[model samples]
Target chain A: MKAYRLRRGAGRTALYIAVIAVSLMYLLPLFWMVRSSLMSAGEIFLIPPVWIPNPPRWSNYTKALTTIPFGRYFLNTMKIVVFNLLGTVLSSSICAFSFARLRWRGREFFFALLMSGMMLPGAVTLIPTFLGWRAVVPPNSYLPLIVPAWFGGGAFNIFLLRQFMRGIPLSLDEAALVDGASYPRIYAQIILPLSKTPLIVVSLFQFLGVWNDFLGPLIYVNRERFFTLALGLQMFIGYYTAQWELLMAAATIVLVPPVILFLLGQKFFTRGIAISGLKG
Target chain B: MRKEEAYGYLMAAPAILGFFIFTLGPLLASLWLSFTDYSVTNVYKFVGLANYKRLFSGADPFFYKSLGVTLYYVALSVPITIVSSFLMALLLKQKFKGRGLVRVIVTMPSIVPAVAVATIFLWLLNPDIGLFNEILRALHLPTSQFIYSETTVVPTLAMMNIWTMGSTMLIFLAGLENIPEQYYEAADVDGGGPIYKLFHITIPMMSPTIFFNLIMGLINGFQTFTQAYIMTEGGPNNASLFYSVYLYREAFTNQRMAVACALAWVLFVIVLLLTLVVFRTSGWVYYEGDRQ
Candidate 1:
């Protein structure tokens, strides 16, 4: 028994060492990005490379921000992100509530249709959708990006919220019904409040999706003034190919909001992913 | 009952409408457009499968080339991602110190924006004055011109892809957790070693999750565009011209909207067929509840 305990202790110690080493490997690129952002241009290109900046240059951020219209890009991204969150949360929850709580005709059929929609790759509809939007709105308008969210959020978001709503006790809605509360009232009060965790998860997912979307902006937006942060960064890289320090600075800035959101709501994020995997 | 039905329809109306307009409508329109000669100049002529004929008749070499590139990417990246994420999940499953922090570090890259991923990797993989090459030199190994060289661009992108295996890893972790500890306890009583338990227990139990990841990974891999678009733009002799990127170029750049539509339908057919094949052959996938 003593020998077994000693072996188990040694095994755990070795596991800790291995985990720490692998964690460092996973984090090294992010560390290098931050480190490079604070170094001088010449320091970045040094033969043996600087592991850490001797005196970190805080001005690289300022230079990078000023070099492009990052402020405008940030505002554009924020506007889209906010609208996307509202649209996804409002629309997905409503649709999900119906699927979960209400007795309706063709409910299962429509739900199956929604699930099938997830399998259709975006490329299949890229052109006609572009033409459909281009006919009504001018090129580079935010409508194409923002308006789709207002529709039914998205198939995935609806599916996620529906899954979460199904887990809520049916007795709550029945109680509300006994008090002569309408379906909308039940959805707004009982269902919405109870489903807060999944709602936040859906919103966070939408925020990340809109914030990091590149292909949508790339397809719809043409002019530089209408570019989101992702598009602006791409344009920045095109013009400043050799400017690694400033580029890293700009990339780091683009990375901040999602990282902050992840840090704040890591639990919901993991739970959401795990639930999706199981159901999927 | 009628009132409740109305409420359900009303609640689901917006999504249904959006589905019809944005998804279903475009899907049908694409099929119609694929046979025509549609371009940006508002000229649409029904050419009766000419675009598809072009795709097959060697008139458009880029179509086949892009398809090949996408297939290669899917083949390379999906297996690597599955194996690596499974291993990572197995590691994280252990009761070690600071395991939570390590899991977070590993999973963080998946949330990092693709544009930023492309940007960071562009510098990291630079042949000169790059971290990877520097490390290689330190170890007295040959440095590679990753992503820049024609031969290594796809593989390098595959490597970059493996860095974001956090989501799949988490899925595997979830799967691992679902596994009953009784299996391992039985294995222990049976005098099974580590490798014996791994093969006889862990792998068979986790097969369903592995299958799920494989399907999703294949789908996503075929749709890979943003990183290749940002980093290489299918350059250095079009070594990295993925199917979607090529389709996009045909639509927007070359003004061949009809051809692009045709390409889209082809991709749809291929993905659907592959998915169907997997579903048909997935008899080996073991689910916990279905004891058969």
Candidate 2:
């Protein structure tokens, strides 16, 4: 009995050490990033290296902001994020309702096609899509980014919203229909209200994706003034490649808004992803 | 069903229209472009199977070499990520202190932008005075000339991928929670040890999630680009030259649109075949609620 008790105690201690060790491996890069960002250029490369700065260069933040068109990039990113988030949430929910609650011609066939889009690598269609956009849209604007999202470009969002809509009992939609409500009215009053969780999930996901998107802005927005935070960060690296401190400081600044928003809304983020993933 | 069908059609119209305009239409367009010697200059010119012939015949050494490098990455990354996440998930499943904080910190990296993650990793892997190399030297270990050395560049990039295992770990955690305690309790009653319980019960039950994560990880690994783009730019003697990175260079830098389109199609075919293989194997997976 004493041997068994000792074995258990040893096992517990080992497990605690392992977990703490692994967790530190994950945190070390982040810690190093912030630490380096606060040091001066020469100090960043100090031998027997400095884990913490003797005097943190808080001015690195100001220098980072000044180097790029940080203000304009933030505005551009906000524009894409807000518009894309709004369009994705509303359109996806409506389409999902149609797939879940409403029956229409070729519903299953179309539904199958939409699911197929989930597996379709965006890389495959990227070039041709860009060329097509150049053909149809204005030469240079945020139109390419916002327009397709409005049209339900990727089916994952719609598919997710659809599953959640399906899980809802049919009685609600039927009851509204019996009251002589129009399809639009049923959708607005009935379907929309029940899908609050998924809508937030879809919206949050779209916001994060659009905000951090470098490829889209890189492809469409050629002008420096129209660059997003991602593009600004990219240009920051190009200009400050040698300046490790300044580059990291710039990246940390760029990384702040998304990280803060995610931490604050982590509950919703976790819950939303869990529910959607189960159905997925 | 008829009235409902109409509504369904109405509902799906937006998605369908969007798919055709954005996805299907472009896919078909690119397929045609692959057969021709298309460039931004002429935009179109039929050239038969010349581009594909060049790829298979090793006419473009960089093209074939990049494909090999990418396959190497997938082979190395998928298993490491799966095993790491599985172990971490198992550790996390036990009742422990600071579980919430650990989970939060683990997943924090995934939500951050790829660029942000890449930048941090670049700093971490920097050769002179970088923390990783510094630690090695401090402990009297042989330090790697990372990012600058061709031998270590790809391996280093693969190592950086270890940080983002948080997403898969969370998914594994969710899968772990759903596993009924009765399985382990019954095993314990039968005098099964920890390793025995893990092999006979935990692993078999977790197979479905494991399979899902494996396929997803493989797919993401094959499509890796953002890090290579910002970090090494496929440098240090092309050690980190990933397929997508090469494709980007072909299309954007070299203006070889036809070759780029061909490369993209080949990757699609490879991914599709792997997905099918996983699906076929998934039948053996043991679900808790489903009886044999």
Candidate 3:
């Protein structure tokens, strides 16, 4: 199709124009976010909205963090994030290894069955699960938020890891089996080492999910002591509804980490997304 | 073989057990609880469809309102995101300088958490001082109340969602990549123009991805919560009372556990039926090798 392709002239310029135009539509709002974050409260609502702030207010970040016990919230969020990340990575990989590498009766059947579990609305399980946990633990407990990771992480995560694991050369694992090495040993020493890319992808996804999760913390933790960044920002919304500068600052704080994480893991993120979407 | 089988079960036990306990058990329990008036007191009486009856019998003020609001959101947002993201993918598929940077910028919003996106949009959509209104005013275009206005809430929310559809566009890009080169070559040989190629080849090949995005979009859209819950709180006389919000308020705020359970089942069924309908009519989806 190179014979007919728009290799030059107005068409190439048109593609460039379209690309830059679309890119701007996404970037402009975020640019506004930073601008608003740096603005003084009075300036936030100025007519024709101030595009550039003279001497950007770096104080807003400090004030935003200090105003709402955001430090405590960050620590609280990190606790859930760390534990959830650990649980998800460990459990989901083990499960995926079974599905992808191990041959067993009803393997394909059970895998399909688990994948179908994604269709079940979280709402269906949400109430009963809450009741179960509330009965077992006190309010404001992180158990409800963290324990789900220990189970199987999530169906999607398991499927992702399994898909990645299935692509590994079977000969290495088969040689271990031929040498009478146990399945666990093979998984631990060979399969896990070989599956680092998907592992990172899964962990990054899990980190972002737990970090950004609002409803879980909302339903589970009622106290200020238990609030994650999401809940804290939510509470900030309530408290600083009129304070646009602080609101933008708080929102930006919550927004930045995940974007940084995505940037750091861009390659893996694309591959992970591609595999999950197309393979599904 | 038996040893291997046992090991497989052992390895997979956590997920399987978790599934039953967290997913399957609750699914059954929710179904059962939907028939009762269970509350936070941990005591209940089986109301025998009273809750569900209340839902459909015009007794529940929020039921229809929330459903309509969410469907309006889903209907608008799903298609908008699908077409826009597909177009984005198409735009990026062409060779261009700085396309990599453009790809990063396009996908950046998707990485932003929902709450943050809502906050940004809240400021951007603020009738008085938001950037959007400023732009609209500058362009001499009519500016509405955005998420604040009852009439415009759903559309505005839907529009904001389109901004963060980077993942959906990536899926489309992948689908675009998978199209056999020979088909495009053959079309070129037959003097088929780009427009003809897009209609005859590209759309058919992409139907499955489009379908996938549609179903997933609907499922996710119907559950629109974080943005609306944080921004609107089902306010402005309940114009933006999404079903998920209504359900959450019913369960947590109102202590209507059984009713919420019923709501959950209703969502499941609606999604299930929609998925089935899509699948049933998905004759346009061109699966490679299926015909042969």
Candidate 4:
């Protein structure tokens, strides 16, 4: 028994060591990102490549941030992201409530139709949608970008929330209906508050999606001041192609928020992906 | 109970309206435009099947090259992603200290903005001074230009797919959790080895999630644009010119709107056909209720 216990302990130790080794290998590139950000431009391309940056240049971050309209781009991204969050949450929840909570004719049919939208790649509609927006909106406006969020968010989001809302015990809504609660009231009071997890998940996904979106702004927003961080970063690269140190610094600045968001909302992000994947 | 069919439509009106405006309307418009010679600067004229003819006739230099590049990329990425993420999930599935922290670290790369990822990789794969080449030099191994070479560009981008397989790994982890321990114990009772249990228990049960990831990976693979646009610009001889990149160049750069619309329809048809094939052949996927 003592020898058997010793063998099991040995197995556990080996497993832990193996895991640690794999984990470091996985994080090497990201660690390199941060390390590269701090290095002087010459040090970045050092032939021997020292692991640590000598006399870490803190000015790189400032220089990177100030080199162009980084602040303006950051603000533009935040503005777009904020409106998207509001519109997606408000509209999608309402749509989900209609499917999950309200009694209706052709409910399942509409849902089936909506779910089919999931399979339709955005690429199919990219051309016509661009044409559609360009006809009405001014060349430099953000209307085309922001206004679409008012409509249904996206089919997958509605489906995710509807799925979650369905699992929230129809009895609660029945109880509320008995109390003469209006459909709007029930949606606002009961479903919205109860469906926080999926909402956060959807919002987090939306935040990241809009934050990192490149193609949309690339096609629409040609003005430098209207550019999102992703577009701005691309523009920065286009001109300063060889400014490796500053580029790394700029990349780090853009990367930090999403990394922090993922860490803080790790559980929600995992749950969201899992729910969508498994039930998909 | 009060009947609320009117209210149901009323509340869901925004989404319904959006479906018409955003999805169905554009889909039909794009279809029509495919059959027309619609350029932004000129008045439109009907040109039946000419755009489609141009695509397959080898008249357009970019059409076949883009299609081949996209297929090559999808073929490389999908299997590698499924296998690697599954293995990562299995390793993380084991009970260990600080597993959560380790999983987070492993996945941290996925959340980085794609542009930033492209920027970093641009330098990291730089022929002379990149970290990868430096490491290769240290190990006394031969190094080649990764994304700079036409033959290597797609494969290199496909390898980068591994970096963003975090969400896929999480999905696999969730699917792994759903597999009951009883089957594993039953297999153990019969003196089955780890490999036997893996083949019999874990994989069969996880087949549905694997199938889901496979479809999603392929679908997203078809839409891959940012990396090529940012890194290669479909260059080193248009070797990496993705279909979307080609489409964008035609539509936005050249203002050949009708040709671009035709490209979009071709992509839509291809995806529809591929989805049909994948679904029809998904008999290997085992649901929880399926009998052995």
Highest TM-score, which number?
1
- The DockQ score of candidate 4 comes to 0.79
Question: For candidate 1 chain A, which ten residues in a row score worst on lDDT?
Answer: A271-280
Q: Select the stronger candidate by DockQ from 1 and 2.
A: 1
Best by lDDT: 1
- The candidates' DockQ values read 0.83, 0.64, 0.78, 0.79
Q: Please give, for residues A1-280, the per-residue lDDT of candidate 4 as tens digits.
A: 9997999899899889879987887787777878988998788877788789889999999998888778999999898899988999999999999998787888888888888888887888999999999999899677778888889988889988998998988888789989999878888999899999999999999998888888989999998888889998998899888888888888988988888999999999989988888565
TM-scores of the candidates in the order shown: 0.98, 0.96, 0.97, 0.97
Per-residue lDDT of model 3, residues A1-280, tens digit only: 6654755566878877887788888899889889888988778777866789867999999999888898899899999999999999999999999999888988888888899998776887899999899889988999888898999899999999998899999999889989999989989999999999999999988888888888999999999987899998888888987788999999999988899998988878877778878654
**Candidate 2 chain A, which ten residues in sequence have the lowest lDDT sum?**
A271-280
Query: Arrange candidates by DockQ, highest first: which order?
Result: 1, 4, 3, 2
lDDT of 2 by residue, A35-129 (tens): 98899888877787877898999988788878777887888888888887777877787788888887665778888987787677777898898
Best candidate, DockQ-wise?
1
lDDT of 1 at A199: 90
Interface RMSD of each: 0.8, 1.9, 1.1, 1.1
For model 1, residues B38-86, the per-residue Cα lDDT tens digits are 9979768899978898898978889889988999988899888999999
Q: For candidate 2, please provide the TM-score of chain A on its own.
A: 0.93
- Relative to the unseen true structure, what is the Cα RMSD of model 3? 1.9
Models sorted by lDDT, best on top = 1, 4, 3, 2
TM-score of decoy 4: 0.97
